[model samples]
Target: MGRYKSFLRQRYRAILGYTGLICLISGLVIISPLLALLAYPEELPLAWGFLVPGAILGLVGLGLWQLLAPKKATSLTLQEGSVIVVLAWLVAILVGTVPFMTIQGLNFTQAMFESTSGWTTTGLSVVDVTKASRLILLYRSIIELFGGAGLAIITLSAIAGPVGSGLTSAEGRSEQLAPNVRRSAKLVLAIYTGYNIVGTIALKLAGMGWFDAVNHAFAALSTGGFSTHPESIGYWDNAVLEIVTIVLMFAGGLNFVTAYLLLKGNFKSVVRNGEIRFQALMVPLCSLVILFGVAIGLYPQLGKAIRVSIFETVTCFSTTGFATVGYTEWSSIGWLMLILMMLVGGGAGSTSGGIKQLRVYILYRSLRWEIRRMLMPTRSVTEPSIWQGERRHFLQDDQIRQIGIFVFLYLILFCIGSAIVAAHGYSLQESLFEYASTMGTVGVSVGVTSADAAPTLLWTQILGMFLGRLEFFTVFVGLVRLLRDTRPILT
Candidate 1:
């Protein structure tokens, strides 16, 4: 009984320590939206929208900090780490909705949907962008910036020691940018910030105004897909701007390690990357499938068809959520190809979300190797291997099994979400498309999701976005931990 009490005390202290740190970080981040009001002095009175909430969070965080100060070296268990991450995200979404809630005609539910969508980088919007204020637009863009950098990477860097590696992994990252967690965090921030700067300048040169350029840069590079305009990329109709966006989105979808390599001037390593090669092969191939279908009857103009085909293919493949045209207007064959691209999303370790290209490559290679083994003589021995960057790794049964399970769960969630949407009186095709977009974290809408969407469907998509962004395992583990810890209360 004494030992059990000690265990509970330790766990409670850990929660307070970690959760307090997260609140402090979130409190500081919450104040960033107020900068938008500053940028537009005419909206000065709107400052209280962020200021009130930011002050409350900041005070709460400071109180926790003083109340549960750490004593000595502390270690976080796997369960604690996962739960902390889950809690942090939930808090961020809840706090992020404050500004949206302050706006008229938007309620708590709509505010939460938008907040989750932005922080998850899902890019879906419940409110119309054209009708939103400049401060609101900037706040929306800034949240995507936060999501792209990842709150875990930012906050964990300050306090994560030997035990903190698991914290980063909980956020779905495997690579350590540096041996020291802090240095690794700084390196990642530098690269992410650099891309935003370059992408913004490139877009401005391509004929976008300063305000639009900054927001679009944040969205495209994060694969967040939030647009300042109602028509999205189609709003400008500038081929140069579209091309520039395509390039930035493609870059964003590539693994961050690939970006690090380029920054380090290792071109050869990038060229040999398995995910890079697979992406190169799939983009044009998928576009051709779309082009062929659209060219036959849907779009008679060759130029228009080719342009739309490439844009949508890249958009879906990258999971960037930007649409040049309404995909529902395309043929069934085109929709299939686009949906397939969403399933086989961008590379692992990228801002883009989905099953990820690495897993797809592994599955494909494993199947081919299996075929060869079946045709070989009974005694013949064969081993399957994959090339990632310059390293070669022989396929292990365990690794393949894990990949298979992740992909399976992802699809299972997609199907379940789609069924729920269909229950609300939408067609299967429409339900599947929107749910796939939600579960894949790809933000394309088929008009089913809106301010008027059923609350059930809204909550369903929220679950999909949260699960999809965390990639299932973290949330699953977190839930298991929560139940296990609550046994005393249940009794």
Candidate 2:
């Protein structure tokens, strides 16, 4: 026990120091939105809402970094990495709340919900954009921008050291665009930024103002559904803009590795990728079903039905959550279809959330492989493989098992969250739809979430968003490790 304590003490300094460095980066991120003041000088009075917390967090981070500075470089364990990732998110969320609270006069619950929603890229906002100032609205997008890229990735890109694979993997990213972790992190940010710039330009060309263009670009490319207008894409009601958003949302939903391959003109690899193939199959089929089965009946015009079906289907499948229309009047079938899409979500290693298409594709292939195994003679041996990026990787039994476990846990949490919402007097379908959107981090709403929502319900969705965005494993393991680490000191 003494030996164990000594070891933990030695490691804790490095862990806390790295965490402090993450906090330092998050402080800079928090302060970045103040630059929006230059674009909207009228909203300059609200600058203190950001500056105060930013300065305090920066100073606190500096102090921790100095005080907890490790004597020498030490490689972080998975547990340490997970704890740091979780702590950074919590600190950023807490600091993010101050702006909403100070500028918008939102209570703590409301402010935290908005902050969590943005950071999680869940886009389930409580803020009324119509009432929100330009600076405040920009700040929300800024959070989504950085949040979607991830704090850990940003930290990795900005620094060099022992922080590497453990940190990246703990943050739910595994694939690196470059061989070096730092280079890969920078590549991700660069790719993400390039997409954002293109998206902004496209939106501006489609007739949006400069501010709206930038904000929507950030939100869309992050797969975050926050909009400058309350009606979302429907506010403009422009097909050109909706098309731009759809392209950006779909781009955002692509795995970073796949995006890199595509950017390098490796079309063959992109085409052969399992997640891409799954998306290609899922999007069109679901869109057609909604169009003919539900949308046509709802709207007599074929064009409107087609537009609504395609846009909403992509949004849900990508977990992007930008709605061209509401679902208050949609049939149960339409809602169910959308709920399923949200549950499946986008490609792994992407900005989007949910079960991830790669896992779903694996499960589907695993079922086929199982049937083949059952049919084959006892002496037969076979290998199953799927193309990911440029390589055809063989699937291991343990990998399949892990994917199954994750899906099972995901469904269990979804059910529990849905039940909590249903207990609040909503219909089962509405509850399921709302909670699916929450758990999947898809921001489409059937009206269950609001600024005036019960704190319990809001808190429930907040937990759902956090869990859904980080996925379950990293968070659960991080919390358990945290308890284990602190127990010695507490006792």
Candidate 3:
């Protein structure tokens, strides 16, 4: 047994060592919900809910780390990094469900769904928060806060080496805010912490109680839409709260690099950023279109219409999933507009999930260049460039092709997910809406997801949320690596 354990460690240091450390970290996260009970002691039994799994996970993590910790820190291959990310999420979802199972009569499927939703920052839930304990509610919010921080960034500060950078990149973050991996990780953590503090305070001043404010701030900045009330943000009916959440959600959905630049007063870079410019244009334009639809049919009053429009549009664009008004009552046009927003998603390298605005900008620019090429003579040349932080670099053909493929795969997955849901007897539009919500990681369900939902549909939604959050490739590559890794054992 000892010889085999040693052999495994020697062969796969990155996988076993890093995954063990991550499990340890997740165990700590699982226990942190106890602080919520300390802050608001609503249900005493809920402490046991988290404690049992937390302790078991901690022991397992300790055992794995002891057996597998590498003698020295080393870089991880892209495949290794991908495996670590995927493995960490699988364990996270498992441990995250402990409290849910303890809290109610939820089966493993329902608990897994809620846990995946929270950790992925997808915000879809089968449990009702109104009936849930404060500790459970706080635990859900805490999941978003850390989940938004990205497991790589959180664990990177402690794990020194190029492995951190590889893990960050695997999770879709490309920018480095500081010199070393640890410093970069810490800097991003600081930025996220600052945002959490400021957002919580702002929400509190906007009329939410301290607990609700903290939870909503965590959810909004994480783009996780778990709400204390069933109506989401609409329950408050406070314009101030809505506006505060809008700002936080937008900020949350922004690229960390852009946010860092803006914080440093680099306004010019933000202005030149292609993703920012695209979001600035697309958000308001889509809102106006939805507004027009709502004005004619849903809300006749101008003020009411405008508020709902901006709230829903920002929520959808940011992939935050909060609802000020149910789109079920909206016209088909309204639903289509929001669905398009969900498909476009928010900035890459941010907590928001979907096909991403960066790819959309690239694909759109590529489209125009294609048309120009078709119209011009064969000998003519057109420079296709996009604005980055400080410079304008011409877009490469490979880059364009990759972006196109990503968008194509994303739409394909959406259709596949929709088909799975539609097989359960839903209409085309309903399936599209539900799958779009899952694929975008945007939790605004059109009546498909629920506690009573079929196990197949529930699991499909779970798979969709996981794939969407990781943007597909990481998980796929991880699976391939897993098969390869296990071949020796199987043989």
Candidate 4:
């Protein structure tokens, strides 16, 4: 027992220290909203909401950092990395909830839901945008921006040390653009920041005010669907704005590695990428289907129908969830199609979420390979591979098996969440669509998610968003490790 206690103390010291550092960073993030006061001095009274929590968190983090700083340099295990990732996110979300509760007067449940949605880059919202202050709206966007890049990546970029590959992998960012994790993290941030600046400027030139442009740029690039207006992109009714947004969304959905390649004029690698190929096929195919089968009848004008189809399809396929139109009036076919798109999601190692395109494409390739294997002679063997970036990676059985398990678990959770929502009297289709949106981190709504939603429903979607954003395995493994480490004390 004594030995086990010593093991826990030694092993967890580094983890706690890292988590403390993340909390300190989160403290800075929480207080960032106070900057909005410079533009709108009327919102100055709401500053305390951010200040109180930020100070408390900063102090707590300082204490933990001092108390738990590792005595010597130690390597972080996968389990330790996962725990730090989960703890960092949870701390951010919890701290993020403060402003919503204090300024918006949202109850704990609603605030947590908003915080989770923001951090997960899941744009589902309970706040009434028409009534919410700009400060609150910017706060949501800021969190989404940071959340999309990930806290772990931010930490890696800030500190110089051997943080470990496990930290990046646990955060669902296994692909690094540079050999050094810190350099890769900085590159990601640089690219991400550059895009946001460009998006904001483009939107501003496209006729949006600076405030709206900045917020939408942040939300769009982060693949977070939060809008300043209730109508979202439809509020502008400007094709140019939508075009700019589409470009931003597409950029957000590309894997950072692929984006880097494109930026470097490596068109050949981008063309050969499996996930890009999948997206290229999916966007047009789904758009055509929606346009012909569903959108045309809904809109009398051909141009309007085509626009809606392409926009919504990209929104779902990219898991960006910035809808130009509401789904309440859409037919069942449209709902199902969007749900499928959400499930298929965007590129791996991107801000967007869902069962990433890489996995689905690999799964499709694996299916073909399995059939070919069965048809071949007993002595025959063939290797299957896919191009990710500049390299062709051979598909391994273990990799396929892990992806299969992940998809199976993802679908099971989707079904379970849908059923839970359906039990509240929504039809199976509505329940399925809503939960699919939740679990995919896609924020499209069919009127099920609102300010008045039941706490149980909100909580269920909260869990879904958390699981979706963290990609399940990390959260599960982290929790398991947490429990195992504390089992002796529990008993």
Question: Using lDDT as the measure, which candidate wins?
Answer: 4
When 1 and 3 are scored with lDDT, the better candidate is 3
TM-score of 2: 0.97
**Cα deviation of 204 in candidate 2 (Å)?**
0.5
RMSD of 3: 2.5
Question: How big is the positional error of residue 302 in model 1, measured in Å on the Cα after superposition?
Answer: 3.4
lDDT of 3: 0.86
Cα misplacement distance, residue 444 of candidate 3 (Å): 0.7
| lDDT per model vs. reference | 0.82, 0.89, 0.86, 0.90
The C-alpha TM-scores of every prediction are 0.94, 0.97, 0.95, 0.97
True lDDT of residue 281, candidate 2? 88
lDDT measured at residue 297 in model 4 versus the true structure, 0 to 100? 89
Candidate 2 lDDT over 1-491, as tens digits, reads: 88888778767777778788878877877888888878778888888998999888988888777888575545666778888888889999999899999999999999999999999998898998999998888888888888899888987886655445878898888988888888899999999999999999999999899999999999998998898888899999898888999999999899999999998999999998999899888899999989987899998888889999999999998888889888998988899899999999988999999999999999999899999999999999997899998889899999999999999999999999999999998999999999999988899999999999899999999999999998789998888988888877545
Worst 10 residues of 2 by lDDT: 69-78
Question: Which residue window of length 10 is worst by lDDT in model 1?
Answer: 158-167
Where is the poorest 10-residue window by lDDT in model 4? Answer: 69-78
For each candidate in turn, give its C-alpha RMSD to the true structure in angstroms.
2.2, 1.4, 2.5, 1.5
- For each of the candidates, give the backbone clash count: 0, 0, 0, 0
Deviating ranges (above 4 Å) for candidate 2: 69-73, 489-491
